[model samples]
Target: MKQRGIWPDEFTFAPLLKACANLEDLEMGQGVHKHVLALGFGRFGSIRIGIVELYSGCGRMMEAKKVFDEMPHRDVILWNLMVKGYSQSGNVDMGLGLFRQMGERTVVSWNLMISLLAQNGREKEALALFHEMRNGEFEPDEATVVTVLPVCAQLGELDLGRWIHSYAKSKGLYPNLVSVGNALVDFFGKSGDLETAITIFNDMPRKNVVSWNAAISNCAFNGKGELGVQLFDEMLDEGVRPNDSTYVGAFACCAHAGLVQRGGDLFDSMIANHDIEPTIEHYGCMVDLLGRGGCLKEAHKLVETMTMEPNAAIWGALVSACRTHGEMELAEYALKELIKLESWNSGNYVLLSNIYADRGKWEDVEKVRVLMSGNSIKKAPGQSTIV
Candidate 1:
């Protein structure tokens, strides 16, 4: 069009910069910036948003802010973009400041800030903000419902979550949006309401991979291993391909219920049938299953031969199994591996000392005590939060 002597307007560069931003191509965005300035389009609000989008999308927050500060008339969309830009840069404080400064707000704006808070480990603040959003003029939308349900689940805010579930149903959001149904399933399941979780799962208008994952994992969590495994089988029969997380939950159910042979079949078929490569998480679950079933040697061998290095959780599982099965020597070895990975964890030393004590080796127990003293480690007392 330019070669044909057709001039580019605000429409041309706004999306071009958006594309650059989406691709995170800083150099291409800068070139577009130069074109915008040469064409005097930077003065236009829409074009300025594109400029901000390009800069912030590429993680250049300062440049985006400069463009943002110069805008004479900022709409809620621009404010939302600024919040998004700051959140993308992991600058939650700046995003919150911009959010608070907005003269007017939209659900998109609230959603942006709430998501930034939740993703940054500020669940309490995110929940508060959601309440504020509710108390105010703006009604939570589908995005708000999806984003906050997990935070509610994390915080054990059962009342708030139930309210949101009702709100979604009232707004005709649940089951209509597969994501809303999936979120409700996850929230209810984690909240220890397996009955409601399963109800939602069955009532979902559609079920995706995530829907199945939430159900199977929740069943595993609630110690309903039989039902969990049945769901896994049903999922396969329904021709929905299980991903890495699906196998993790299924293997965990096997471990919990002592279905070692079933776990092994799933592990083998994960590669053979589904073509999904086993990650370390899958291997961890299988090792956990073998260990729980008293197959110490097989579990140990699998840990040593893992494609990726076994992490602390794997060693912890092995040591826990050893104690349960009275395999003191293997427990000692697994504890040592666990210690190498987490030397500061006093529990590993305590476990090692206990293993020695079980074996009538007082001297080894004293040495483990000395190791703990030398490292300035203290056993963290077990505490439970009622909420």
Candidate 2:
């Protein structure tokens, strides 16, 4: 267009900015913003909103805010853009402050705020906002239900999650909306309502890999490890390609059931069959499975030969296995790696101390205690709940 002498205007600027956002080309987006200013389109509300959207989409919150602050007049869409930018950038305080400053809000505003709060680990506040949204004039939409359901999942708020399920049903939202359906499965799974989770998963008109993962994970969560493995087989038979998370759930199921051979096969096939590389989590699961099955030597070998540098989790799994199987030497080796990765972890010291005590090595146990005292590391107190 520049070569053809067709200069850009405000009408052209919005789409150009949107294209930049879609492509996530921040440099090109900023160049377009400069052109907008030079072309006198800076004063246009739509152009300004587009600029804000471009910056926010690129995770450039400060730049987005500068564009937003300079806007002479702002609309609900602009406010939503700013809130989304801050929320997504993990600036929940700024997001909430901007939200409270809005004189008027659309449903998108409420949903964005709730989603932000829920995503940032403020489940209680997110739930409270949901109540406020319910009493307001606007009705919660599919997006609202999808966003809030995860809060219930995280908090294990079974009752609240059930209510959301009913609401989704009443609104005819589920089955048609795959995301809401998936969220329902996840919520029920996390809340220990495995039966309901499986029911929801089976009832969904459509199922994705996530849906399969949720159902399989719920089986593992309920300690029905074999059942979880079966579900994984069913998922593969149904032709849903598994991702890394899918394997995580599957390996966990095998670990819980002490299905060493099955776990080994699954781990080996991750790269061969699925073209998915085994992550540290997968390697850790294999170690735990081997350790629990009394394959301590194999577990240690697996850890030693892991392609990636063994992290705390991988070493911790081997350490745990060593303790369980009475392999003090391997346990010590694993403990050494654990200390290197997480010297500050009191659990590691405690585990090592317990291992030595189990073998009647009071001197080693005393040394472990002395080390703990010298490092000033204390075991975190345990907590329990009674129903």
Work out the TM-score per prediction. Answer: 0.89, 0.89
Per-candidate clashes come to 0, 0
Specify the highest-lDDT model's number. 1
C-alpha local distance difference test of each model: 0.90, 0.86
Query: CA shift at 227, candidate 1, in angstroms?
Result: 0.4
lDDT of 1 by residue, 1-387 (tens): 879999998889988988998899999989989999998888887789888888887889899889888888889988888898888788889899989999999888899899999999999999999989989979898999999999999999999999999999999998799999999999999999999999999999789999999999999898888789999999999999999999999998887788999999999999999898888789889888999899999999999988889999999989888889989899899999999999988778877877787678888877887787788977668721111
Residue-level lDDT tens digits of model 2 in 141-224: 999988988888888787888998998999899878888888898888888888888898889988889888888887888888
Those runs of model 1 whose alpha carbons end farther than 4 Å from true positions after fitting are 1-10, 360-387
For residue 73, model 1's alpha carbon misses the true position, in angstroms, by: 1.6
Candidate 1 has an lDDT of: 0.90
